[model samples]
Target: MNNAQEARRILRAHRYGALSTLSKKFDGYPFGSITPYLTDHDGSLLILISTLAEHTKNIQNDPRVSLITHDQRDPHIQTQGRVTVVGDAQPEPEREKAGQRYLRYFPEAQTYFAMHDFSFYRIRPVAIRYIGGFGRIHWVNMNNYAVADAEAFVQQEDALLAEVNARSSNALCRLLQQRHGISAMEAHAVGIDCDGLDVYHAEQTWRLDFPETAGIESITESLAQLLTATP
Candidate 1:
């Protein structure tokens, strides 16, 4: 796939990133914070922050921000793939909807979501920097990195994962082995988007991309087909 698509793949596979905001307290300097984010279908990022948070305050003063996420599986940091999203953060009024989407990826944050101090901020990306590997880096345009029909699989994710783990776990493990050459004793489906599936196995997360983007019905069919084709 292209660099933009590859960057989105990396973002889809990972859950946390380093968020940098213009420091409101430090004379407009950049302040960095470790944050967990969820991507919307339109390529924006959703971050939950408390009113007391430093980054939150920073964003209020200056909406311009940047977030960077890289592959953790790779030991050689310089050679690993990573993406940087430069954007503007604004309050997302749809808290309930954003909470539903965020909690699915970070269920542990439920308590935080219930608190009145916490709020959801949506970061609309203006530009993206995607580094695929050593010497394979390029700046990807927002239009090229956009995810179409993110809701296609997101709405059905919970039920779909339950079914995959219950009935197709073995097949998924086999598919993992077939593609990555690593055998996982047990695999749990953590997330799925139009482009790929995220499988948690052996205490690590693995991404397996589809041959093509998949919709709700096609995703199930694709997994079944992979199971039979893997051998």
Candidate 2:
């Protein structure tokens, strides 16, 4: 695998992350929140926040933000590594598409969705601070990281997702409905990295990034075909 693939592997391993933003309520102090963010095809963050959410309000006041998601394991806790994303927050144009992608990974978000006060936010990463282990860390500049339009993920959502979600076919869909308690209406692709693909369903985002047998070119081609067929 390449550097991008390696970096993506570590990222897909963890989900929950702490997001820090400038506070709008308390004299602009630093405000931190435990948020669920989905990574898009090119590695940028996609989040859905309620308009009434403190972080959403804070972001409206100041778009700068950071998120830290780390590996959860024994010794790794001390320095297993956490990827920090520093970027700008802005409402995404593709709210419906993003919401579909996000809710799959976080099924519990159904409650949030029902409220109808939330809106989608997309992060455009300027730089990524990656820590491999204790004392082993480096900053990734834009050139080293992939920064594509937010639409890329949305545009490829349908077709590629079918392949990934269809792998286990009926069983996986049934499992999501029975065990996960998700209606599982449809599956959308929220993430695609050099390592694998992420297909969102309900509360559990299924990660398909098995580096040992991931085919980036084939997937890319499939997505390309789907887009052309979009009329």
Best by lDDT: 1
lDDT of 2 by residue, 89-139 (tens): 998987676777677677778788767688888888877787777787778
Give model 1's TM-score versus the native structure: 0.84
TM-score of 2: 0.73
The Cα local distance difference test for each model comes to: 0.82, 0.67
- lDDT by residue for model 1 (1-231), tens: 778888887787777899999998989998999999887656689999999999999999999999999866678889889999999999999999889767766778999999999999999989999988879989997677876666666677778778877887877788789887887778877766677777777655667777766666687877666557745
lDDT of 1: 0.82
Model 2 residue 51 lDDT score: 93
In the order shown, the candidates' Cα RMSDs to the true structure are 2.7, 7.1
- Model 2: worst 10 consecutive residues (lDDT sum): 222-231
Residue 116 of model 2 has an lDDT of 69
> What stretches of model 2 exceed 4 Å from their correct place?
1-5, 73-75, 147-154, 167-193, 199-203, 212-216, 220-231
| Cα-based lDDT at residue 113, candidate 2 | 70
